[model samples]
Target: MSNNDSIKKTIIVTVLLCIVCSVIVSAAAVLLRPAQVANKSLDFKRNILSAAGLLEPGKNVDAIFNERVVTRVVDLKTGKFTDAVDPVSYDQRRASKDPSLSTNLSADEDLAKISRREDYSVVYLIQDENEQLQKIILPVKGYGLWSTLYGFLALEADANTVVGLVFYEHAETPGLGGEVDNPVWKAKWVGKEVYDEGDVAIAIIKGSVDSSSSNAVHQVDGLSGATLTSRGVHNLLHFWLGDNGYKPFLTNLKNGEA
Candidate 1:
């Protein structure tokens, strides 16, 4: 073949190869998208179950989740459930970034230091066979020592007592800030009172909680050697449970107004 003819042939082959590769990639993405979404949803349900202390060893997460948990969307400001948003498809993190769906936080009100906050949030409800609400799980996130920590805080129906707490995502030092995941540390949160006289009063103390102290009901033992992470937990709890967070929803629920 002449040099010019050979060059043209080479270019055509390269272009065809690129086109074929792109088609394959596009097809794969389309085919796998549903599974990806399902898995993401399953993982989220698992986290919710874990926070509610309903997760069991070797159990099917989907089955247990569907049987035990009910998902609902709440308006933070109004403290009311609204059918305007679908709980199954609502993405709180994504909504927080949307200008129309979120509100900017002031420095004083931003205890979690989350500058932008979503106006609506998803809450998980667990009820007994009688359909009486037993527990409510709230999603919470805040900045930790190295990165933001995202977690779920489960409360008893009374609204002030904690049932369980779990951090599903974070980027903190292993064995230090990472100790937040320690089952023992998490256990300390159980039965801790989150509110005092209608105020958010829970605190992740600097060290061990003093059981004899008057404020012991609102205190949980801090993560050993993870002061920053512990403080992040404290701030996030206060932020999410306070007036700007779910306080209105919780108040309504407590008053039977919800």
Candidate 2:
């Protein structure tokens, strides 16, 4: 056989092909990163709009978001708005992992099962044409049955009534835990009250909410056959709305101090 047809030559050719493929893939990834980041940011803003019921079909997400939403950073400890961090670039999830920017939670204090909580959170505000607050969308996350569920919870101007909710990311049993994505289940969140006399009264039950019950306004039907995921949702909501979470900030918002 010719030297070019030898096994050594074949191996050299194969190695060269692999190296070329790798280099091409690396270059493509580098070139596409900016677009990827932009798309991700757009998707997130779209999710925020959808959570607040502001998303319209066939409309430009970026234009509608910029026109209707204002972003602010809140000090979780003081429940007050702060300029310490740039609201536009601050990332709560990333901050939560930083020791200086977050606090470690004890078992009893961490109902959401998130080990560390960020000191400040980025909150989105929807306003009327007259500049009055219409809705406040807060980002929340916690451990679910198999993965962490990240989502937004939008409250009305009163800060007690639910406007809407939508999870942007999660991995759970498709028919069970993943039912959180179901429109019927999500619609149930609308108009529910998050507080009863300064207490976080919201809950997720094993079955459907009883409209006739006095407590119905605070209760939501749990995900069928996904008790843990349902419980996680309840816990995360509780944590985010409680003292260690956005409660202080929300109080400030209610008092017009935020």
Candidate 3:
């Protein structure tokens, strides 16, 4: 073949090789996507049940979630019962336009780290015999050591005291900030009151609680060397539970709305 013809042949070969690789990758992704989704859903259900103090690992979560958990969407402003919406499908970025999901945030609401405008947040209301609500669980997500931490916070009927707090996902350092996931440490959060007479009272202290005060704030000692991670959790908790967080919704729940 002539020089130009040989060059052309080489270019054609390279192009074909690239196309074949791309097609193979695309096919593999398509084949694996469903399994990835299933695994994610199964793990999410497990974590949610764990946060609700219902399930242990290696246990069946689907049956328990179906039997004990009731999920709902609410108007944040009115704090009343509303139509059901899927939390997984809700677009937090486009939530401003959802007429039923009332909020003070305008169309220009900051699309920050977490999607603020979710059509509906996942709320797990646990029940007991006589069909009465026992624990009210709400999802909490905010910035952590290196990324946003997503977890669950279960509150007592009073809406002020926390019943349990558990972190399901976070990217903090393993030996330091990641201690937020430690069961022994998180257990301290149980029975901790979030606020004291309209003021934010909950805190993660650097050391042990004094043990002298009758009503000392719930204190989780900071990881010895993880200042940033500790600070991140502190800030996020305050931000999420404040007036802008779930304060309004929780207050209404306390008032016997939903």
Assess every candidate by TM-score: 0.89, 0.97, 0.80
Each prediction's number of clashing residue pairs: 0, 2, 1
Query: What would the per-residue lDDT of candidate 2 be over residues 1-258, giving only the tens digit for each residue?
Result: 687579889899999999999999999999999999999999999999999999999999999999999998888878888899998788888999999999999999999998999999899999999999999999999999999999999999999999998999999889999999999999999999999999999999988988899999999999989999999999999999999998888888899887
Point out the higher-scoring one by lDDT: 1 or 2.
Answer: 2
Tens digits of per-residue lDDT for model 1 on 1-258?
699999999999999999999999999999999999999888888889988999998999999998999888998879988877888778889999998999999999999988989988989999999999999999999998999999999999999899999998999999999998889888999999999999889998878888999999999888888899889889998999998999999999989887
Task: List the pairs of residues colliding in candidate 2.
Answer: 79-248, 79-249
**Candidate 3 error regions (>4 Å):** 1-14, 84-88, 92-120, 215-217
CA shift at 117, candidate 1, in angstroms? 1.5
Worst 10 residues of 1 by lDDT: 82-91
Deviating ranges (above 4 Å) for candidate 2: 1-5
Question: How many backbone clashes are present in model 2?
Answer: 2
TM value for model 2: 0.97
Error of 3 at 142 (Å): 2.0
lDDT for predicted candidate 2 compared with the true structure = 0.94
